[model samples]
Target: MWNKIEMKRWHRLFYDQLVRRWKQNIVFAAATIFFLQFLIVKLHPSEVQEFNEAQCADIYPKLKQGLISVNEGMRTLVGHELKLIGEKEFDVTGYTVKRPLLNCLDQEDELLHRTIKEKYFVKGNVSGRGFSKPYEELKHPYQTQDLLELVFKELRNGFYVEAGAWDSEQMSVSLLFEVGFNWTGILIEANPWDHQLGLLRNRNALYLNTCLGLTVRPQFSDFVFTPAVEVKEGQWMASMGGLSETLLNPDSIKLQCFPFYSILMAAGNPTVNLLILDIEGAEFAVLKTIPWNKVDIQVMTIETDLIGKAGISGGSQEEAREFIISKGYTLFKHRNNINPVTGLENNDLFIRNDIVKKWNIKFPEPLN
Candidate 1:
C-alpha cells in the first residue's frame, strides 16, 4: 500500500508534469497592447466585432509573472499556468509565456477595494436582501451581468472560472466579480494569448489561450481565428476569435484541449462560486469532462445550442442538460435570447440545489 507521503510525492510529480515554467513581465504585455491598438486602427479588422471596442484595464500594471508563481498543486495550476498536457502535438510558437503572452494573473485586492469605496457606494451588505447599488456600474452583453447580480446579489470575494474568455474586457462575465468584488477566476481562450495580451494583462485571474474538451486524455480541437487582419506592414485589424468541431475555415488552427477537471484540479478545486461556459458549441462535450461529485460550484451559466444538432454522434443538448441536472443543479433560469453577462445565446442559469437550500434561493422552473 502507498503511504501518505508517497501519495503526496506522486501528486507533486503529476502537477509538475502537467504544467510548465515561464517568465514574462507586464511591461512587455503593455507595449504589445499599445502596438496592437495602433495596428487595430491601421489594419482592416474583421466585421464580426463591434467598432470602437473599449480596452480591458489591468489591476496591477507592474505585477510580474514570477510574483504569481505556479505553486504546483491542484488549485495552483491557473492564471500564470498555461501549458499543453499529455503530448505537444501542436505548435506552441506563440504559446511561449512572457508577460501575458498567453497566461496572465492580475491581482488587485487593495486597489479594487479603494476603487469600490471611492467610486461606487453600496447601501446594504452583499448577502442581505433588497440590495441596491445604483453606483455599481458593470456590464456584459445579453443581460448576463444583470443575471449574476440578481443571482449572487453583490456576493464578494468569490471564485469564477470561464471558458472562451476572449478580449478580456468587452463581454467578460467574470470581470465584474474580479474588479468589483475582488473575486479570483480562470480565463480560458483558444485564441493566441498574445493577440489580446494588451487587454488581458491586468485581469485578477489567470488568462489562458486554450480550449476545453471532454476527453480525459490529451486531445486537439480545430478552431477558427484570424490572429489579425494585417492589410500592410505594422497595420493590423483586431483579432477575430472562434472555436468549432468542424474545420470550416481553411485557415483554421488546431488547439490542444484539456479536460475541465484538469483545470479545476490544478486550482485546488476550490469551491467555485460561478462557472461560465461559452466555448462555442462544445458546451456539452466540455461539461461532460467534469466529475460533478468531486467538484463544488455554487452557480453555473452555460451556452447550449451547438453540437449534437447534426453531428455524426447525434448528441443532443437535452442529454447534456439531463446529465447536469442529474448531478445536483436545479434549472432555475433559462433564456433563449443573449445573456447580457456572457454575451452568448441559448443560455441556461442553474443553481446547485445545495446552494439553493443554503442560500435560500427561490427561483422559477426551467423554460422550455
Candidate 2:
C-alpha cells in the first residue's frame, strides 16, 4: 500500500543488509577453514622409517612381553581385514605394502595401515600373475628362507642339505625349496625332541639323526641342551647345537655326532645345490672340515653368529668369509638383521663363483 518511491527505498535497504550479512558469513567460513588446516598441519607426525627386521632385536622382547601389544594386535587385525576383503592368503608380516594409503582405507584401517607403512618396506605386488605367492604368507620365522625361494624362482630341481633343521617345517629354510620347487636333500638335527618332530614333518627329505663335526662318533658329550631344569614359567631356555669346549659345563647333555664328509659319501657325493649349516655355535669348525675342492656345493647359508660367542674364536666372521672366499665362493647375502631381545645370530649366504657362472645366476645384496 506504500507509494512506489517509498517501496523502492525500503527494498534497497533490506537488500543492502542481506548483502553485508552474506559477506560477513563468507569471511567467517574462510577463517574457520584456515584454522582447521593449520591445526591438521601442526598435529600431523612425520612418517616413520621402514622397519628393518635386523634392527627389531631390541623391540622383540617388548612384543613378546605384551608391553607393545599394538604390533601383535595390528598383525591379527590386518589378517582379519585381509580375509574380510576376500584375500584368502596374504602376508600380514612387516614385509607387505610399501606405499602410503591416503583415502583407500577406512578410519581405523587407515590408522593401522599407516602404522605398518611407517615400519616396513612395501615389497608386495598383489596383481602379478603366474606368481605363486611372491612370498610365503606364514611358517617362515624370518624372510631369509622366503627370499631364498625368490632367488631360485627359475630352477625346477635341486639338492639341499639343511643342518639344524628344527622340526623340519618350523623355520626350516629348506622346506619351501623342497616342497614348492620339487627339490630333495638331507636334513640333519641332533636334538631328540626336534629330530623326532622333523621325522614326522619332513617326509620328502632324508632325515639324519646325527650332528656334524670334523670327527664322526657314535656319541658325543657336553653339548648344551635347552629347556634347562631352572627354567621358570614364561621363561625360555637357550641351546646351540655346538659350543666352544670352554663354555660347556659338566652337566651338559650327550648327543650323537658325525662327520660331514661321511654324510656326503653316504649320499653318493651328490652335487649340492644349497648347503644350509646352522649347527648353533660350532658352525665354523664344521665348515672348515668341508673339503670344498671335493664337493660341488653351489650355494651355502651359514649361521655365522655362532662365532660371536665368548670363548669362541678362530671361527670369526672375518676368518669364515676369508675361508669361503679361498674356496672360490662369493658372499651373496649376509643377514645380520636380528632383534636384540631374541639375540638371534645373523646368517650368511654364499654362492660359488664357478657355479654362478655356470648357472648364470645373479646375487642380491645383504638384506641387513
Candidate 3:
C-alpha cells in the first residue's frame, strides 16, 4: 500500500510538470505564429488577403448569405409593423411656445407672489400661469416676470437644491438668479472640462468636482461620458456611466466616494423645496440614499428612459409614478413634445402633494 501511494504521488508530480511544459510550448507556438504572420503581412500585404481567400473562401459566401437572409426576415417581420404604426412626428422649434397663464384675482405684484407660491409647491401648468419665454430670453424685460412666476408657482426661493448643474446655459440657473431665490446650493459635477465651463456660467454657484454616493467612505469612483446623438451643441449633457462599463482602459479612470448628506450639509441645509436630479442613472443611487424626512424637498424632476446604458433597470414609468406618489409627489406635465418617431411630448414634471393641496389644483389620474 505504501509503495502504491508513493507511485500515485510521483504520477501527480509528473502530470503537473507535463501540463506546465505543455502550456509553455503552446504559448511559445502561438507567439511564434503571430510573429511569422506579422512579418509576412509586413513583407507582402497582398498575400494576407490571398491567404484568407484560400483558407475561408469556401465557407465565407455561404455564411454571408445566411446572415443577410436572417436580417431580411427580421426586417420584414418587425420593421414593417413599426412602419405601419404611423405615429405623428413633429419638430421641437424651440423651448418657448404657447403655454397656459395663471388666472388669479389680485394686483400684479400680489398675483406674482401668489402665482410663485402656488407653482412653487404645486405641479401643473405652472409655466402657463405666467408667460411664454424662451430659454435664451434670460435677460429679457419679462425675465423678472417669468422668474416671479416660477418662484411663486414651482420654486421655493430659499429652500431648493439642484444637482448636476452642467453649465450656466441651463434654464434653472437663469430663473434662480433672475428671481433672486435665496439659494444656498452645491453644484456637483465630475467632468473637469465641463466644471470649468460651469464655473464661468454659474459664477455665483458653489461648484464641486466630485460624484455623490450613499456614503462618505473614502474610495475611488468612475465616470464615463457618452455623447448625445440627436441633440446639437449639448454633447456635455450626454448620459454618464461607470468607467467599467464605458472606458476602454478601466485602470486609467479614477473614482471618489462622497456621502449624499455631506453635500446637503455643504449646501447649508436650507429647507429643500425643489430637488432637480438629472444625474443620468446615478439618480437611482442618490435618491435611494436621501434622508427624505430631513430634506423636505417638495418637487423633483427626473429623466426616465428604457434605453439607459447605465446598469440601472426595473423602474418602469408606472413604477416611477408610484414611487413618486409614495414620496408624496404627483406627475404634473410632460414637456418638449419633439418625439423623434411620432414627435409628441417627451419630458415630464412631478410636483409635491402639499403644493397641489395648498393651491387647490387638480390633475387627472395619470395614464398607466
Tell me the TM-score of each prediction against the true structure.
Answer: 0.56, 0.55, 0.49
Off by over 4 Å in 2: 1-138, 141-150, 216-219, 227-241, 308-313, 334-345, 365-368
lDDT of model 2 at residue 235?
41
Count residue pairs with overlapping backbones in model 2.
8
The better candidate by TM-score, 1 or 2, is 1
lDDT per residue for candidate 2 within 272-314, as digits (tens), equals 8888887755777777666667778888877665454522445
The alpha-carbon deviation from the true structure for residue 344 of candidate 1, after best TM-score superposition, in angstroms, is 12
The whole-model lDDT of each prediction reads: 0.50, 0.51, 0.40
TM-score of 1: 0.56
Could you tally the backbone clashes for each prediction? 19, 8, 24
Task: Summarize candidate 1's per-residue lDDT along 1-368 as a digit string, tens digits.
Answer: 11112322354565344333312556655754565454333222232121121211231243233333222111101112122322332222243121221122211223322322332211222332121122243245443554554677788889888777754554567766766778877777666643244132356565555566546533445555432222234543322345555434443544545567666665556899888886545778767667787788888887654435311134555777787888888876543354222233455777788887887766455542
**Candidate 3: tens digits of C-alpha lDDT, residues 1-368:** 01111322354565467567767799865764564354333322221111133433443354344432211211100000001011332221101000011111111223323323332211212123221234345332222232235434444434445565544333343344424544445555654434444454433345565555533222234454442212223322223333222322321233333445555554445665556655554555556566667666655655443223243433444455566677777676432322242122233456677876775545434332
Worst 10-residue lDDT window for candidate 2 reads 76-85
lDDT of 3 at 39: 32
Q: Best to worst by lDDT, what's the order?
A: 2, 1, 3
Regions more than 4 Å wrong, model 3:
1-151, 154-156, 171-184, 214-219, 227-252, 306-309, 337-346, 362-368
lDDT score for residue 204 of model 2: 63
